[model samples]
Target: MEHHIYIIPISTEKLEMTEDNHSMTNEFILIGFTDHPDMKTLLFVVFFGIYLVTMVGNLGLVALIYMERRLQTPMYIFLGNLALMDSCCSSAITPKMLQNFFSEDRRISLYECMAQFYFLCLAETTDCFLLAAMAYDRYVAICRPLQYHTLMSKTLCIQMTTGAYIAGHLHSIVQVGLLLRLTFCRSHQINHFFCDVLPLYRLSCVDPYINELMILILSGFVQIFSVTVVLISYFYILFTIFTMKSKEGRGKGLSTCASHFLSVSIFYGSLLFMYIRPNSFNEDDKDIPVAIFYTLVIPLLNPFIYSLRNKEVINVIKKL
Candidate 1:
């Protein structure tokens, strides 16, 4: 327990103590993972397993991309970066969250909480932009075969990736910077699992009308613009897939884009659920699962979808 702070407890013992004394609620209590009396250990084990799998899968993807010379193509170049982002994002949130599963004190300082949310949002946004860029690569490859090399040249690939990092950081900073402007005199308890902007704002005593508008506008532009571009590229790719003269050519094209399609679905689907709608549209049962899906499940699934599903990648991994 944190010094001078009475934390919300996980057990009946703590619950009883709280009931007897009523000396809690000074710090944030995360009502996540599970609330069952007997299921605590089981929940911990399950999440610890998922965390291990996520780490190994993302780390393995990064390692393979780095070690394999033949796998250093434009597509795999973006894949490697995405893998790194997934690993970093998961590490930033999940390990601490897993610890919170057992620890009584989940109280985070306003600054520390905002920092956590900032990096998590930054990495997530970076991955989104990177996926969009990779989709554009596939669009060029399938939709313009002859120009694929020139369109997605080594120099162009680096520029796209660098642009993703910059755009993601810029997009993330608006919210984080705005969050820094608020003074937290009212309460310190965050509602959701981590220190997400939405949950934090709900607890703020000050009117976050400006901050809310900024979040919506900035989030809308980056998410909607990126997703729209990717969808448009895939739309053309799909049209070309149906019209391809060679069955092999069509199959190859679909194979190349399939992993990305799955990843985008997993990411954008979860994100839209979490962020696209206003809080009026969100309920606890609905939002909590979506939050966990985006923050936890997607990272574990991204590398597998990208690496094992691609023939060239699988061959590279098998050889390694």
Candidate 2:
């Protein structure tokens, strides 16, 4: 009995030490796009060009709206903010991804990972609200033209913008806080290009039931609420446009909403696929491709989508 007691205590101490060692992991290796030498160079050049263009385009749009007095209405205000968030979303993922292309180590520290996800989440969440706001603005303009200025006032625009950021920050803080509770002691290698929440959950030694639940609950609520606002607003705008007596008026309203809805459909479609799903864990292969769309491609496309179809912005560019 005495010998057995000593053996059991010794085993317990060893087990504790092992757990300590596992929990002390401070960094992770990001297994990015490709390992082939030639492919790396090709991908690096392609993505570098993308990153440069994304920055220039988004920042240029923001600058244009800020400098132009004509573009001072609610529509442009929301558009400018959307461009800024797109830049942020690209910056959160692309730079590190580019570096990892040539880096042999491809290592990202745990805290660094947390920061990446926080900014990404903030930009994405803010974008959802911003799109919804833009939809409402369009509805007011097209559906209720007489009270457009009164309904979409400057004060209300600023308030909605502020509210979006507040919600984004709150969501990000809660997500990062939940991440801190997890001890990632299994595999140090993350499967995706960047340290996304889902991939990190797959690495956790602890069961991430609560983390997954929170992601579904929080992300679902944000997306659903924002999407609901957008849908309701657009429904009214559509009805108003069809009821217009003049053909020119109907065409003008359709043209205005077309560009906005195009951007919305692409952005929301990719996001809905990424987050609002039950089997995100098993869909590892699909994650990288879908993430590339929202994180890189959407930002690049938005500038062109909004600008090419906008006569006011085009005239402003021509004047400049």
Q: What is candidate 2's lDDT per residue for 55-110, written digit by digit as tens?
A: 99999999999999999889999999999999999999998999898778788888
- Tell me the number of clashing residue pairs for each predicted model: 0, 0
**Against the true structure, candidate 2 has what lDDT?**
0.92
Model 1 lDDT tens row, 135-235: 89989988898998888899999999999899878877888889777655454555567777777666666788888888778877888988998999999
Which pairs clash (backbone N, Cα, C closer than 3 Å) in model 2? none
Clashes of 1: 0
RMSD of 1: 8.2
Q: What is the lDDT of residue 172 in candidate 1?
A: 75
Against the correct fold, how does model 2 do in TM-score? 0.92
TM-scores for candidates 1 onward, in order: 0.87, 0.92
Candidate 1 clashes between residue pairs 3 or more apart in a chain or in different chains: none
